[model samples]
Target chain A: MSENIAERVKKIIVEHLGVEADKVQDNANFIDDLGADSLDTVELVMAFEEEFGCSIPDDAAEKIRTVKDVIDYIQKQV
Target chain B: MRRVVVTGIGVLSPLGYGHKANWEALVKGQSGLSKIRSFDPTDYVSQVAGHVPVGREIGQFNPDEILSPKEQRHVDPFILYGMAAGQQAVQDLNWLPETEEEKNRFGVYFGSGVGGLMGIINSGKSVETVGPRRLTPFAIPSILINLIGGHLSIKYGLQGPNIACATACATGSHAIGEAARLIRDDRADIMLAGSSEAAICPVGIAGFSQMRALSNHFNETPQKASRPWDKERDGFVMAEGAGAVVLEEYEHAKKRGAKIYGELVGYGLTADAYHFTAPGGTGAKRAILQALKEADITPDQVDYINAHGTSTPMGDLVEFKAVKEIFDGTNVAMSSTKSMTGHMLGAAGSAEAVYTLLAMQNNVLPPTINLDNPEEETAGFNLVPHKAQEKQVTYALSNSFGFGGTNATLLFKKVLNET
Candidate 1:
């Protein structure tokens, strides 16, 4: 279940950043690998919030750095 | 300075689609106001407008008509309206320049206040639902105010200076005056000039409703809503249309055997800077005086004044005061055509100019309808209320004042001699 959730989150990141799914792995950083600016990152978080039906606060949004971080946050919130 | 004369005129107003029909309707004192059928205004405070009814077929985008189908789809309705009127002006006068120099020396000058409001509203909806990526590439070009001039230049193959002046409601007057200046300064032999507007959209209605700048008293009786100078007047009823006129140099037009209507004698422009939206009334007086001085005519020499009474309480009162100050108790025939056509915004100036010329040509002044009881402040002047009056008008002045405190006054005189 955990692996499945991580795969789903990674797919979303890859689609949002226009990158390959494999490149947006658990260990890869969003800025370094996925190539997202500050606004893009914020928008990505908003899309995730809407898609997952989860509320991500500003502080929690700041903590999300990678696809794995988003998966973890969604897991904890849901 | 060179002299300029009106050679041709065309219009698509609330009364009808052509000048003759509109003139007939005006002479019959018919009202064009009706309930808002273009959009459902059940929730809107102001629920009426003078809309050009749908299903009236303006000829297709043939090369002879105006523009191509592709180009027509990308432009706003105002531009389409302008093109229709421009094409009619060209056809009515059979203005076929045989030489390249004649074509090049002809230019276009048009104006619009709120261009492509319908386009903006559609784009706004698309952006909200499908995101900004769904916005069409032609959205900005279609909505820009100057596209009226661009479309005219392209359609007619005019190569001279193409310009557009967007000064809110005064746009039409400014455009006509500027085109005349081009002729007066010997810049162009012929100039296509006018203004158009299509601001009767959801956002436009909502914005004007929020500002309380539109009439709300006659949601049920829309025809009686736009009552200018009446004690019961509330606010102006929004209107949409276009008006165009072809101005040519006196000797040049006569040499080409063009039928001239009247001579454009003077144009005066001024700014109130008193308030953002309201006129100072004094500044309008100055503009009128400046136009009189430029025309070298006294107040009594002016026989008719087409007043820009928008039916708004403040606007009507301020225009009355301004006219009084300009005329100084002299008997001058004045009438607010907004009472019949509603407020055409940027198109009002040009539409009123056409009416003024028609009055000069026919020796009749159209009445200000819907005025059952004149307001206290509006009683002094000869408002020409209720019924059309017959008068021998030699010289006429038309005034148009818009938001941002901008004002323009134009003087026209009946052509007496070829020189």
Candidate 2:
């Protein structure tokens, strides 16, 4: 289930940001490492909430910065 | 005063993809109108349009051909057609300023009748069904009316003025005329100007249908739906496409040995202020006179006119009256390419300008196909019905009128001293 969550997060980032899938590494930052803007980060959180069938609030969404952050958030909610 | 000349043209029309292809189709009386296939139009009253041909019969339009897949996903279809046509115009001219200084002299002026109707309609549906969070981030940029100019400017690195006109049906013609003024006023040496439209989507059909502006009688025979100057004509058929031309200053074209298709000599614009949807011969007459006066020629000097003639019952009658009043019963030939291409809205004017230019080049007047019965008002004029007429066209005028009572007339004179 955790592996599935990581794969889903990576897929969303790749499709939404139009970045290469391989570049969405665990330590890769959302803005610094993946070229995501403030709006893109917000939308990425929404995508995670929709995909994982969970509601992420503002403070929790703010805490995510990298691919691993999104993967870990989804795993914790699941 | 710098003179404006048409050096190159690019057409992505419902009839075909390129200039020569559209010309051949028009001259041959081929109808690009048929049943709508972009969506299921079974519930709509007006079920036909001049849709750009695609699918297996005609090759699909790969947007990636002009824009990268990521970029293509964000823009509207009108921008796609506009970019393709704009690229073709630049390529046909073989003119891309190599240096940054030269690029600064090039500009773009493009418009659309209804921008991104499909995008708006789809996004509206998604909001109702799937909720607002599902909306794409690119929706705003995709649906803006002026993004055709934005997309083309980005693609060509054009550094001069970027203009976008949304004068409804007259949008394309106004874009061309206004862009010529930019060159004439020394603002830009070269301007890529025209219009593109992809408004045959569900909302476009529904909205126009509500206005009673679309044909309803010919759903069974879509080809005969747009019968300009015929008594049986009901209304105009919606269409989708783009048309573009590279307008360069005469000296610049001559210096570069660019092939000049025709010289744009006069432009006239006016407003009716009468009704939102209705047009009057009074405004059209004044606009026609303004153009002729600027060209410094009488109506007798004109050999042909590409009439707007959208085949609407009221519009055709008033426009024919306007033509008769402008020419005062002269024998100059006039016809509507809309008889074949339907009403392309914003793209209609530029596409018809291309046809008129081609007619001047070849001296072959395209027929107003399906004009089997001339309305009594059209009896004296040579509607050039059912067959292409070969004539020595020295000067020609193209008329485009749109909603909001806007009207534009462009005059082009053939080069007589070319040796």
Candidate 3:
């Protein structure tokens, strides 16, 4: 289940950034590796909210730095 | 100073398709407001508008009437309306100057407040449903403001300075003023100038509703809701339409034997910088004074004033005070065409300009419908109410102010001695 959640999160990141899904791994930083701008990051967070059926407040959204952080946040919320 | 004259006119108003129908309807005092049928507005606050009644059913209009099909699909509805109006204007003048050089000497300047809200809304829905990846490739091109001018330039093969202005509601007047300046500066011999708007969608309605800028009192009585200068006036009824005019140098138009409607004498633009969405009365007064000054005409010389009266409670009052200040004590014939057509946003300036021009041509000022009892806020002005007025309109001024505290006023003089 953990592996599947990570895969789904990676797919979302790659799709949002228009990057290769294989390149968006757990350690990949959204800004540094995926070339995502501030708006892209915010939109990514929104996508996460809709996909997981949970709310990510701005304070918590600020702490989400990498694909791994998003996965962990989703896991905790779920 | 170089003189600019309107050689041709075209419109796609709610009253009808062409200029004749629109002019007749205006003269006869016909209201275009109806129940919101384009979309379900039951959940929304503003439930009525001057929507294009047959837009969808008209589907994929013959671009040969304007341009080829391949070129038509790339632009937004505002641009489509602009192009169609521009085509009509060009055709009416038989303005196909024989060589490519003449084509290069003409340009297009158009405006739109919200470029392609329908396109944005449709693409946004796709993003919400099938995810962002399913977004169409034409999304960005269809929503940009400048593409209206770009498509017009391409369609007419115009190579001169083609530009688009987005001054919210003052956009059309700004476009016309800027295009006339180009003629004054000897940049272009002729300019296909006007504005278009197609923001009558779900998101468009919802955004305006959220701002409390639309009428919510009349779901059952849509026509009566847009009551300018009336005691019961609540708010403006949003409308969608476009108007275009062919502005050419007076000598050039005469040489071509084009029918000259009137000479565009002066244009004035001012910014209140006071509020984001509301008008400051003093700022509008300055705009009107500047226009009259630029036209080198006295206040009493003006015969008719086409008001920017959006029928909003505050907007109508501010404009009334502005007109009062400009005319000082003289009672100029003033009427808000928006009372009948509803507010057409960026296109309001040009639409009102067309009405002003027609009024000047026929010597009849169209009525400001729905003004039952003039409010105390709107005092000491001759607001032409209920019925059209016939008068020798030598000089007419049109005012349009927008959301960003932008204001534009245009002056037109009837051509008395043409021979």
Candidate with the greatest DockQ versus the true structure: 2
- Runs of candidate 2 with Cα error greater than 4 angstroms are A13-46, A55-69, A72-77, B55-60, B416-419
DockQ (C-alpha) of model 3? Answer: 0.02
Q: How well does each candidate superpose onto the true structure, as a TM-score?
A: 0.81, 0.92, 0.81
Candidate 3, residue B182: the lDDT equals 97
Residue-level lDDT tens digits of model 1 in B1-419 = 78899998988778767778777777777788899888889999999898864443541122224554545656788888888777777777677666789788999999998888899888888799977643565678788878888877876788887999898889889999999999888889999999998899888888887888899999999989998899888888999888889999988888878787799998889999899886774778888888899989999989999889989988888888888876867879888888888999999898888888988888888889998899887666788988889999999999999999999998999996655
lDDT of each: 0.83, 0.88, 0.84
Query: Against the true structure, whose TM-score is highest?
Result: 2
Q: For model 1, what TM-score is found for chain B?
A: 0.95
Off by over 4 Å in 1: A1-78, B56-70, B417-419
Candidate 2 residue pairs in clash (backbone atoms < 3 Å): none
Error of 3 at B22 (Å): 0.6
Docking class of 2: acceptable
Candidate 3 or 2, higher lDDT: 2
DockQ, in order, for the candidates?
0.02, 0.30, 0.02
Among all windows of ten consecutive residues in candidate 3 chain B, which has the lowest summed lDDT?
B54-63
Q: After superposition, how far is residue B347 of candidate 3 from its true place, in Å?
A: 0.9
Which candidate do you rate higher for DockQ, 1 or 2?
2
